[model samples]
Each structure stands twice: as structure tokens, then as C-alpha cells.
Target: MKHFPIFLAMEGQKLVLSGGGDAALAKLRLLMKTEARIEVFTADPAPVIVTWAGEDRLNLTARALQPGDVAGAVLFYAADEDAREDARTSAIARAEGALVNIVDNLADSQFITPAIVDRDPVTVAIGTEGAAPVLARAIKRDLEERLPVTLGALTRIGKRFRRAAEALPFGRKRRDFWADYYFTTGPRALAEDGPQGAEEALNTLLDTHLNAAPRAGHVALVGAGPGDPELLTLKARRALDEADVIIHDRLIAPEILELARREATLIDVGKEGFGPSTDQTRIAALMTRHARTGAQIVRLKSGDPAIYGRLDEELTALDAAGVGWSIIPGLTAASAAAASIGQSLTQRGRNSSLRILTGHDTKGFAEQDWAALARPGTAAAIYMAKRGARFLQGRLLMHGASPQTPVTIVENASRADQTVLQSCLATLAADLDRAEMSGPAILLYGLAPRAALAEIPQVPEAAHGP
Candidate 1:
């Protein structure tokens, strides 16, 4: 926050440097990659700089720092041991509206040179903001370890394909083709074969049809889990990887989507509260039509497809249409929520039965068998009860459930900001209001476990230190 980080584009600009020793030579070498017009001034230039100058590779002046030399320069560097000369050069350079760097004297310099990792066109600059140069170098080294040496070659491939990509008929088609090519073919060639591999991949992609019509396919109703990507079941991951087209809901996180094949078509069918929704019937029809064409379609839903999820309607549509499909179970939000709060839905003695219920019924809960939900020794897990907690609690109480039953409401379960509020069924509404919480909450009500009910300090009293 102290310093604003920005990447400045200085492809073709004038740069001035004073001194010709090792430090100055190093700076000049770094500048060689830039399309900058560099002017070097030194009473005694290093052999490397002298060699470059003799070979007409660099412009050099065998003279001391002068005020006129800073004019029209976008950047200036003073790498001399003379402190007074460095300060004078820095002042002149700044007055001339140029960024100045003084070697070994950061306090007097306007800018400090950063450790750089350059993959030619892709350069990463690591700056410590004048804190620790060694730290910057260490970070650069770490990045160098992860970044492959073939990245530059990959960039060159991209440059070679830029025109062909732009000339492609449709934007979406071009993007799809490139995305597929990058993952399926680009990585292998770049990793093992070098530039020849890249060239072959590009040639193969360019020669193929970029706008081929999608084939007919079957739709798999797959659950993507609550929020955590790691919670994705193996079947779910496999379904995603095999999907030719994926119609995913809002609750599915980006990480889960990333597992899908890069060529797969993705459509967002997010259902937000009080927001525009993709009609479930329409979604089913789309999936069915695509599946009939032999396209491997995936209807990506949040959590388990069978748990309060609209799998009944989708299945009905699929069955009526005679479209063959399968279901991939995912970790339900209720299960994830329970695990996050360190509680089990069905604990021996605490509750003998467990029931899951939906809070909002399109048809009012008047017809719902509330008595079954309120059965003694049964634990109820209510989904989508953010706005109807009081009404739900009242309905349960009126149907033979005890008002004193313990309840736990979990919000954003299994996520970084997950919160759990424990209270009695009678006080559930009040607690929810006090917490000022909203967004996809699940209610757990049953005979409270003695272990869960035990009071404990908010923070551990003792700090475990070495």
C-alpha cells in the first residue's frame, strides 16, 4: 500500500547513464532488451561497455555527467562512487522530469532498479520498495524456479499465430479453438519438443475447421459441491472433464469449472435470489436436445443433485424425452456445513433420525407433512431458510416439535468466512437478526449433543509456544 505498483511501457524512449564501471555496464546490459535510445557517459568505461561501443552496438560518451545530458531522457542512472556527483546528477535528472536511480544511494534516488525475470516480451519486475534488495532477488529466484524456460518460445508462438487468430470468422469460435489448442497440444510441444512442436501445433490448428457445429450428446446431472473445489467427488470431476458442453449454476466455484476440458462450452445458469433465473424446464430441454445429438452435456449443480436440488424435474424431462443420462453425487451443503461446525447431523442418543427439508415451498408449507419433520428424536436440516427462519420455527413448533429444541444455523458453510450461530428453536429468529447474516444458510434442529452444548472460552487461555 505504501507504493503504487505499475508496469510502465517504455519500449522506445531516451535513457541516460553516468559511470562506466561494472554497475553501469550491468544497467546498460539490462537496457539492451528495451527499444530505448541509450546514452552512456563515463571517464573510464568498463571493457564490456568499451567493446560494445567499439563494435557500434551502443552509443557511448567518454565524458563526466553534464546537465545537458539529462535533457529529453525518460530515465537516468548515476552509478558513480562520488557521492556529490551522484546527488548532482540525480537532482538534474529529476529537474529534467526524468526518473533517476543512484547506485548504492537509494535515499537520494527517485527510483530504485528492481530485480527482473525476463521472458523477453513477458518480464516480471520484483521490487522491495527500497526495503531489501536481497529479498527482491530471492523472490525473483523463486519465480525463476517455477517459470519454464520455454515460456519465451510459447510467447513467440502466440506472436506467430496472432494474425491467424484475428482473421478467424467469429470471436467465440476463435477463443474456443485457441483454448483447446493451448491445453491439448501447446503444453506438450512447449514442454518437450521446443519451438518446432509449437509450430506444428499452430499449423494443425490453423488447418482445421474453427467453426464446426457441435454434435448431439447426453446430459449428466453432476454436483460441483458446496464451495470448496477439493470437495468435488471423483465422479463429478470425471463428468466435467468429459463434458462437451457444461451448463453450470451460480453456486459452482471457478476452481471447479477449471477442471473441465478447456474445449468444453460453458454456460452460466446462475439462480440468484430475486434475480433473473434460467428456467429449469428450459435448461432441461436444452440438455435433452444436446444429448440427443450425441453431445456429452453436463448440468452442473451445486451440492448433491438429489438433496433439495431440482433433479426431479430434470429427470422427469430426460425420462420423457428418453435421453440417456447419469447422476454424479457431490458433497451436499448440509454435510459440508456440519463438518465445518464440528458437529454430526445424527449423533447417537442426541437424535435417532435425520430429515432434510426445503424452507420455501412454491406451494405453501400448508400441505407439507410438518408432523413428520417434527417427529421426536428426529433431526431436521432446513435449506434456504435465510428469510423464513421464524415462520419455519413456528411451523415446526406448532406440529409437535419442542420450542426448546437446539438449533444451529450455518452461513457460507465450508468457506473462508463461514459462521455458525447456535441457539434454541424458539430464539432462532432473534439470533439470526442479531448476527445480521444472510446468503444460503442451513438450519439444524434436534436434541443438542452434550459435547456441543458444553461452554468453552472463545480463545484458548494458554498460548502454545516453543
Candidate 2:
């Protein structure tokens, strides 16, 4: 970020501006909203600038800025309407140790201003680091409409009542009380009986919550999608936001994990193919233990949890623990891989059915119906197939599969580092070896990247079968 967004206490700070035209007027209007003492310096003053000076809204100097003019100013603005003059005044302000902002000249500014949505104590700042002012303004407009004008009043009243509300236990209980007041009880009471009634409502609401039973723990088995944050379902996002304990798989993207609350406890129980991994029993135990503490737990898995994600085993464990749970499905890697290659898992004449397979199981390399899989027009998305390429190749070829049958390997599917390798059954193992793929990948049998079709060499008909 070119400028880190923060709210500064401007109650008694000095803010200097060097301009007399629209640019200066625009900045002054926003500055006046703050409690800062605004000072303007320009040789040729506009009518409104003079009016503001007369009203004592700001102290106006009828002359161009000189060296040390902004010596004690905390913030300086060079909105002089001319590039050369702005640069000169900006240099002066910088020399005087003031953070300078050159209007329309982002490269020369020390800090860039963000578009703001004002709801007093509940203000929202939207910035694009000087990349897209229009987009920032658009977001500001949207937020302004959504936030009620009464929000400021509610927040101010709630601020004074914070100490009184501390009588309830901290953490969830306290949070629940505030949530009810801000979202429900408080708003209803204020609309009917003004600010005084809102205070009465707060006291009444607190008493009810103080005597209520403690909240029960629950679990949400959420799917994070194929390494893409945007592909994650809204329900899954909400689970992350509210989750107190997040036990996620290693395959889940760092970006996806970033969506969770900063205070949330993140535990990585990653299980790599043919590598050291957290035992399934231990993962279940962690969920049950956290849930027993009345904590909201989220079992964040990559892709659709119901598909080959060992959903049944985890659900069985949760059932035994007597903890309630819900599932939020997401886009599987197979679907994302197909989309990346511009192919469908099922086609009208090529394949009528789609199958999802794993490269290995508890014992070793997983077994499949090789005879059927070797047939022409059959399609499958083989997950974790990178490490078992040779086993897959030998099995399919032994079942009379053509050496020329197209195969594609999609690595890091739906992610920024995604790569696609096009090969055939004869060279599937060899090509995968040469690629040196390190990320999670899916192997597509009887399919090739649509765009790379003409580029792939075809095998002779005589070599169709083993």
C-alpha cells in the first residue's frame, strides 16, 4: 500500500493548503469537517476562500507560501492548480517536516488521501493507493447508502454504556450482548422512545442475557474451493468469520485462510500424499475438544468435502461426540481443472459419465476398473495422481488402452501458479516426471487441453492397443 490507512486525532492539529481555486476549495470543504485548524496560503484568493476567512472557519494568508510557512503543520496540501508551483510548495513542506500531499501527483506525495464514508465514530475509509479514485468514490457512495444516519447516535450512546455492560462475562457473552443491542433491541427501542429509551432497553436486555443459558458449541465442515478465494462459497466465508477454532487442511490456500478472523485460532492438519500427515483420529479429537469448550469450530477442507474428502469418517466422529454440524460445499478441483482446459467432464458423444478417482489409499496405489477406464471416450479426474503416475500408466496400458489416448495434468488448479501439461497415455509418466510439479495436481485421462489439441502429436493407429 502506498499509504497505510489510519484514523488520526485531528482535534487540534494544523493543516495547511496552498491553492485558491476549485482544488483548494474541494480540500477545504472536507478539512472543515474535522476539528483541525485549517490554514490556506495563496497570492490570488477566490471569493469563497475570502468568505471562509471572514467567518474565521480558516485562517487565510493573501500571499504565496514561503519557506518555513508550514514549519509546525502536521499535514500539508499542494493543490495550487499548477504542476510547477505544486512541486515547489511540496518541497518546502517536506523540508519543514510536514507530510505533504501533491494534489493529482501521487508520485510526489508522502501520503495519499482515501475516500471516506462519515458516520462520526463509525467512519469507513476506502482507498485505492491512488490507483482508482473513481472506484474508491463508488465504494464510498455504496457504503453511505447502506449505513443508517442513526448509526453515529447509536455508537455514541453505546460507547458510554460499555463500562456498565462489563458486568457480564467477557468474550462470547459480552459480544452477544453488544450484538443484540446494536442489531436488534437497541435499534427498536431508539426508534420508539429516543435516546433515553435506548438506555432503558440496554439495561433490560443485559438482565435477560445475564440469566440466560450459555451458548452451545457447533461445528461447520466448510469447503474452501480449488485454491481460489473467490470460488469459496458465501456460507463457507461466514463460517470462517464466526469460527473461534479453524482446523484447516494443508491444501487450503493461504489466501483462503486469510479470510478468517485475526483472533481465530488456526490449526493446520495438512495431510500430504505419501508424506507425513496428521492422523484422522487426532483431527477429530481436536474438533471435539474445542467444541466441548463451547467454541465454534470450522473444519475447513479444500474443494467439495463430500467428494473423496473423508466426510463420512469425520461426520461419524462428530456424531459420536454429540456435536451438531453443517456442511458448506465448494467447487472441486476436477471442475476447476476442466474449466482451465476448456473441456467438460461429460460430453454428448465422447463420454456420458464422469468419475473421480484417487491415486492412492491407506494401503498404497488405489485400484480402479482399469478395463472400463481404458475404454475410448472414458473420462476421469485422478486426484493425487502425480506420485502414482507409473502405476496408472502400466495399469491402463495393460487393459488394452491406446498409447495415443490424450492425458492432461493440471497443477495448482484454479490458482495463480496453475500450469497445464498435455501428453498421451504412452508418455503420461515420463512427461509428469519431466515437469517436476511440486503443487497439488489432478490428472485428466482421455482428455487434453482444448487449445493444445493441434499441437499434440498423434500416435499411429497400429499402436492403438497393447
Candidate 3:
């Protein structure tokens, strides 16, 4: 943020202004809402300023501002609407050791007034560092409509009962009590009865929650989506929001992890294919342990947990431990990869069926029905195929697949760094190696990139004939 926002206590503080024009009037309207002792200096005071002084609203000096006029002031506004006068007035205020704001001059000002949504005790200030006043006003208008008029009154009531609420344990317990009061019980009571009813409801809520035990912990197997935070499902986002603990995979993006609560525990149980890994048994044990302690746990995965994510193993482990769990499906890598190339997994006339196959399993490269996959018009999205590219190529070729079959590799699918490379089966391995692709990629068979075609590499005569 270029400008840091802060709310200063205005009670008994002095605020000085140096104009009687529209610029001054605009500042005065908002200042009148505060409890500051305001004084305006203008030789020819506007009629509104004269009326305000007559009504004991503000002190008006019918003379030009002099040195020491802003001596005791905490804040000063040079709202003369004249650049020269505003600068001169601002200099004097700064010399007098006060924070000064020159109307419509961001560079000359030490402080800028924000568009405010006033609800007495509750105030929302929107500022854009003087770069966008219209945008700030739009936000202020939005907040004005969304926030209830009675929110200030409700907050005032809450302030009074803060000490009483301290009887409940600090942190989550106390937060839960307020969340229930403000969101549920208080609003309902205020609607049905009045402020008195709301107060009564608050007391009842505190009693009920304080006397009850804490909520049970849960595990939500949430798909983090194909490296894009936007693709995350609403349910998955909610799980991150409410989770006290986030147990995420290695492939999950940092942006996705950012959605989780700041106070939540983040455990990176990343399992890389044929690399440093975490045991599934230990992961399951970790889930059960945290769940037993009543912490809301989110087992975050990179893609759809149902698709080769070993979801059943984790589910079985949780079930055996008597722990409850749920799933929030995410946009798998295959879908994201296909979208990046502007091709459908199942095209009406091109291919009748789409296959999702992993490049490797527990015993290195996985075995599949290569004869069926090698047939004409076959389309498949191959995940984790980077290292096993040669093995896959050899197997398909042995099963009588054509060396000229189209293939595309989508690297870091759905992410900003995503790359789409097209090649034929004869050069699939060579193209992958030449690209130096690092992120999780999906190999597409019988599909090509929508935009540009990749330069096909020359295949050796031996591999082609075989």
C-alpha cells in the first residue's frame, strides 16, 4: 500500500481549515460528523460558514490565516481551491507541526481524506491514494448499501458487553460467540423485537455456547484445481476458510494455500513421483490425530482427488479411525490441459471416447491395454507422463500404433507459465526433452494445439519401423 490508513480519535482535538468555498464546505460536511473543535479562517466567509459560526457549529475568523493559527491543531486542511493559497497555507501548517491536506493535491498533502460510510461506531473508509477518487466513492457506495444502518447500534451494544464476554475462553471460543451473536441470534432478535431483544439474545447465546463442548474436527479432501486459484470450487474455498489445519500436497499452488486461515496449521505432505515422498500411512495417521483434537482439517490436493489421487486409501483410513470426512471435487489437470490446447477431450466426430491414464504406478510405468489405446481415432490425456515418455512410446509402437499419431504436451496446465507443445508419436519423447518442461504436464493423444503447431523432430528409422 502506498498510503497506510489509520483512524485517529477526534474527541477534543483541534482541526483548522483555510477556506469558505466549495472545497472547504466538502471537508466541513464530513468533519462535522467528528467530535473535533473546528475553526475556519477566511476574510470573506461564505454565507454557509457564517451560518455555521452563528449556530456555534464552528469558530470562524473573518481574516486571512496568520502564523501560529494552526499551532494547537492536530490536523489542518488548506481547502482554498487555489493552488498558490493551498500551498502557502499547507507550508504554515507543516511549520506548526500539523498533518496537512491540500484539497485535490495529492503530492502537496501529508494526509488525504477518504470516502467514508458512516454508521456512528462503525465506519468504513475507502481510499485510493488520491489516484482514483471516483473508484473510492463507488466502493464507499457499495459498502453503504451492504452494511446495515443498525450495525452501529449493534456494535455499541457489543462494546458494552465486551467485559462480560471475557468470561468465555479467549481466541476461537470467544470469536464463535460473537460470530453467532452478530450473524444469527442478534440479527434475528433485532428483526423480531428490538435492541432490547437483541441484548437478551446475546446473553442467551453466551450462556448456551459457554456451557457446551467445542465442535468436532473434520477432514475435507479438497481439490486445489489445476494450478489456478480461480478454478477452485466454492466448497473447496469454504473448506480452506474454515479449516484450522491445512494438509496440502506438494503440487498445490501457493496462491491456493493463501486462501486458508492465517492461523491454520499448514503441513506439506508432498509426494513426488519417484522422488522424496511422504508415506500414506503417516498421512492418514496425521489426519486422524488432528481430527481427534477437534481441529477442522483440510486435506488439500492439486487436482480432482477421485482421479488417480489415491482418495480411496485416505477415505478408508479415516473410516477405520471413526472420523467423518467429505470431498470437494476440483477441475482435474486433464480438463485444464485440454482447455489450454482449445481441444475437447471428446469431440463429436473426432473421437467417441476419452481416456484418462497415469504415466506410472507403484511399480514404475503402469501397464494399460495398449492395443485398445493404439487403435484409430483413440484420444487420451496422459498424466505424470514426463519421465515415462520413452516407455509409453515403445509400448504403443509395439501394440501397432502409428508413428505419425498426433500428440500435444500441456505443461503447468491452467497456470500463467503453461506451455503447449505439439508433436507426433515418433517424436513425443524428443519433443518433451527439448522443451525442458518441469511442472506437472499432461500428454494429449489425437489432439493438437489450437494456435500454432510445434516443429516436428526427426525420428530414427529403427524406432519408426518397429
Candidate 4:
């Protein structure tokens, strides 16, 4: 950072300008917007500056720059065309401890003016750290379009509420109430009736929730991401915004949770393999109960709700109770894992079919239709198969699967700690055991694995027998 950019509040402060031409007039106009007392020194005043002084809009002196004139000024601007004069003015201003801006000479100045968009009380300043003012202005233009004109009104409403809110007994509780109101009522009011509407909305919210306890709510199964928030489906974001309660798993990143309404209840219901599991039935019942009382429940899952998310049982219970519910599909870990390695699971010639199955079956591997997974050109992606890899591999081999079939196990797919282990079907178990990779691993078998193996370097074979 070339310059530590800051917003200087110049209201009711002294500002000194040393020119009266078009460039100087522009700076004068900006300074006038603030409550600053501006003193301008010009050898010859421009027509525009004369008109402003004549109307008492600006205070000016028609004289050359003097060393004593810059004293006690908070900010100074030197816009003269003469380089020597500009440098002299800058040196004097700096010696006097005033932040100075030398127009068109970034290197000679201690401060550079930023391109500003003032929707006042909500001013936005854009700077390129004195590198590119034109580029900064272009960016500011783009931002001006996305920022609503009503944001100024919204900010004013917040100003109105600050004192009242601070006076409330419970800081967190008061902040929570206003936050909820700001999103729900205040925005709507601002959109409908501008500042007046926002004021009314804030007042109503403060009055209504003054003595209230936080409401009870159920959990929602929200899919945080396959990795990126931009990849989040519209439905997923909507679920998060509406959720009164969020019970997210460990796989969901903090960045994803930031999308939720700031005041929404957040709970970590994260569980790892065979560790302190949250009862599915209990979760379902909690959601059902919360929904009955008009609370929005979100049970945030890691991936697409339909894929290995235990949705079948939750949906069954929700439906049986007649609770209104819906599912928002997310980028599943399988798709993300394949994407991370740049290997398409449904590659045309390498694999014509895709099968997703879990390695662990409650009834054991004997009950699983391992034969179906042995088909040629079929690619199977196994979920949570680290512990049962040996049994599962043996079953696939017995069911006519090729002993040399390519396999890839991806752990923590799409995450920073992601690791991919490539091995043949014969060595799948030993390779997995050697890597000691666990926690929701995805197993890719068959031709897709062949494609992936062909792309990535192979791992050394395990010493143990296949």
C-alpha cells in the first residue's frame, strides 16, 4: 500500500487552496460541500471564483502565495501550472504540517484526492494509492451503478436509531432486534417511501421487540458450498436468508455462513465418523417443532441434500408431520472432487455411466449389489468408504471387476487440505491404509479413474499384499 488512505472529516475545519482556475474551482466546489472554512489565494481570480466570492459562497484573497497564509490549515491544495511554484507551495504546506495535494503531481504531494461518490453520510471514496486516478474514477462509476440511491436514506435511518439503540439495556439483544428489523422492515420501507419509511420501520421494530425474548426456531439443512459462494444455487441463498436457526456441519466454511442474516441463530451440529453424532430423528423433530410455530429452520449440510446427506429419513419424518419444507441442491463433493482434478466423471468414451454409493452398508458388504458396480465403462464414486475399502474392493473383484481397475480416493475434496490417492483396484485398501486419509473420502472406480490416473502421477505401491 503506497498510501494509507483515510477519510478526513474536514467539516468546520480550515482548508487552503492556492489557485482560482478551472482545476482549482473544481476542488473549491468539493470543499464547499463540507462544512469547511476555505481560504483561497490567487494572483488573479478566475471568473467562476469571482462569481462565487461575489455571492459570498467562498472566501478568497487575490494575492500570490505567502508562507504565513498556510498556517493552522488542516488541508492545502496547490494546482498552479508552474512546477517550481507547486513544489514551493507543497514544501511550505508540509513544513506547516498540513496534508497537501499537488494537482497532476502525485510524487511531489503528501496526499492525493480520491474519486468520490457522495450519497452523503454514505460517501464512497476510491483511490489507486496515487497510481491511477482515472482507473479509480472508472471503478467508482461502476460502483455507483450497483449502489442504490436509497442507501443514503437507509444510513440516515441508522443515525436516527443509534442513540435509542445504545440506551437499551441488553446490547446484543438490542442489536439483534434492529438487525432483523433493518433487513426485513427497514429495507422495504426505504424502497417504498425513502427515509421517512425507514424511520417508521425502525421505530416500529424498536417498539415491538423492546421487552421480547429471542424466538425459538428449528434447524435447516443448508448446503454451504462445494467450495465457492458464487456456485450457491438461488434456493440455497434464499434458505439461508430466511433461516431463523442454522445447524451447520463441520464441512461448511465460515465464509458460507456469513451469507446468513446476521441475527439468525447459528449452531454447530458438526460430527465426524462415529463421533458424537447428532441423532437424525432428533434433528428432524426439532425442525418439525420449530416450523409448527412459524420459525424458519435450516439444517445446513455440506453438499447436495440428496447425495449422502441422510435426507431420505429427514424428508420422511418432515412429510409424515405435514411440515412445509423444500430442498436446495448444491454442488456435490463428487462433482467438485472431479472438477478439482480436472477429470470429468461422465467422460464420453472413458465412462458412459456414473454410480454413487456408500462403502458402508449397515447390513455389511454381503447385502450390497457389488455386481452392479463391476460393469465395464461404469464409473462408481463411493462415499465414506475408508474403513470398508478392503471388503468393498474384495467384493468388487469377486463380482468380475478387473483386478487392475484404476481407483482414486479424494479426501476433503475441494478443501485446502485435499489430497488425492491414485491406486489400482488390487492395491486400493493398502494405499488408503498407508495414506491414513480419512473424513468423507470419495472413491472413484473404473474408466473415470483410468482417465484420472493417466493425468496424475502414480503413488508408490504399498508393501502389504493386495
Per-model root-mean-square deviation over C-alphas = 8.0, 2.6, 3.8, 6.9
Backbone clash numbers for all candidates listed: 8, 0, 0, 8
Q: lDDT for every model?
A: 0.78, 0.91, 0.89, 0.77
Reference-based TM-score of each model: 0.65, 0.92, 0.87, 0.66
Candidate number of the best lDDT? 2
Model 3: per-residue Cα lDDT over 37-111, one tens digit each: 999999878899899999989999998788999998999999888888888888999999999999888897888
TM-score of 3: 0.87
Model 1 CA lDDT for position 462:
32
Compute the lDDT for candidate 4: 0.77
lDDT, candidate 4, 1-466, per-residue tens: 7878788877778889998778898888887888888888888889988888888777889997888888999999997767898888878888887989998888877888888888778898888977777899899999899887777777777887888876555534565676776567877887788777778877778777876765543345656556557768888898888777787877787778999988777877676664577777777767787677757788888888788788888888888888766677788888877776667888776567788888765455434676777655568778778888898888888887767777888887777777888787889899998998755678877634434555643333342123
TM-score of 2: 0.92
Per TM-score, the best of the predicted structures is: 2
Q: Per-residue CA lDDT of candidate 1, range 122-148, in tens?
A: 789888888888899899999999877
**Runs off by more than 4 Å, candidate 3:** 53-58, 72-74, 452-466
Off-target runs (Cα >4 Å) in candidate 2 are 186-200, 452-466
